[model samples]
Target: MSSLKLKRFIKDSFPDNNLIIVSNREPYLHNKSGSNIKVEMPAGGLTSAMDEALRSTGGTWVAWGSGSEDKNNVDDNDRVAVPPGKPSYTLKR
Candidate 1:
């Protein structure tokens, strides 16, 4: 099924509540490219679906951050507001 359909289903399934996705593998991987950090999203159906869902619902994604630059982006509690410009979710590492 499409991400739009999944998002709709998720919203319908849990109305008046927030969505939290917890996983061992992080959706984004931060790597050091020279002096800058590059964020990479792995290619996977589940990841894509979750990204779409979170983007649409403005939810929280909780995962273990194993990236080299993950710590650099997080706050005291290891939480970071993602997507830079227009943050739609909180990434809790």
Candidate 2:
């Protein structure tokens, strides 16, 4: 099925509710390089599939951030608003 269809299904299944994704691996990773941080999205996984829907609806993605620069990117509670610009999801580490 298509992503739009899946999104529709999810919305239909759970209206007036927030989408939460819990996983071991983070969808996006941040790597520090030469005083700059490079954001990298995983090639393919559950995160890739649900990213669009989450981006559209705004939600929370909880994951174990094991990246080298993960700690620096998160807030006091280890949560970060993602996508860099126009963030729609909270990445909880």
Candidate 3:
């Protein structure tokens, strides 16, 4: 669905409630390739499917922080807003 429609649906269906998605793997991964931090996309459709839905709702995704550099990205609260440059949701690793 388009983001507009998704947003409207979320706004109507879950008003005053927080939207959260918990998964075994994170949508994005961070690793140290030599000295540079590289962000890697998972090798499946799950990320693509859930990303927009979460983004539309501005939800929180609780997933395993399996990446090597995962700790370096989160705040003191251990939450990282995801999709990097155009962040729209919180990721609690």
- In lDDT terms, which candidate is top? 3
List ranges where model 2 is wrong by over 4 Å.
1-4
* Residue 75 alpha-carbon offset, candidate 3, angstroms: 1.2
Task: For each candidate, give its TM-score against the true structure.
Answer: 0.84, 0.84, 0.90
* Residue 70, model 2, lDDT: 86
Question: How many steric overlaps are in each model, in order?
Answer: 0, 0, 0
Q: Write down the worst ten-residue block by lDDT for model 3.
A: 40-49
Candidate 2 lDDT, tens digit per residue, 1-93? 676777788788889998998888887788887788888787776778777778866789999887778889989999989877768799999
* Worst 10-residue lDDT window, candidate 1: 1-10
Per-residue alpha-carbon lDDT of candidate 1 for residues 1-93, written as tens digits (9 for 90 to 100): 676777788889998989999988777878788999998787888887787788877789999888889988889999988766677888899
Name the candidate, 1 or 3, with the larger lDDT value.
Answer: 3
Q: If both were scored by TM-score, which would come out higher, candidate 1 or candidate 3?
A: 3
lDDT of 1: 0.84
Residue-pair clashes, model 3: 0
Better of 2 and 3 by TM-score: 3
For all candidates in order, the CA lDDT equals: 0.84, 0.83, 0.89
Model 3 CA deviation exceeding 4 Å by range? none
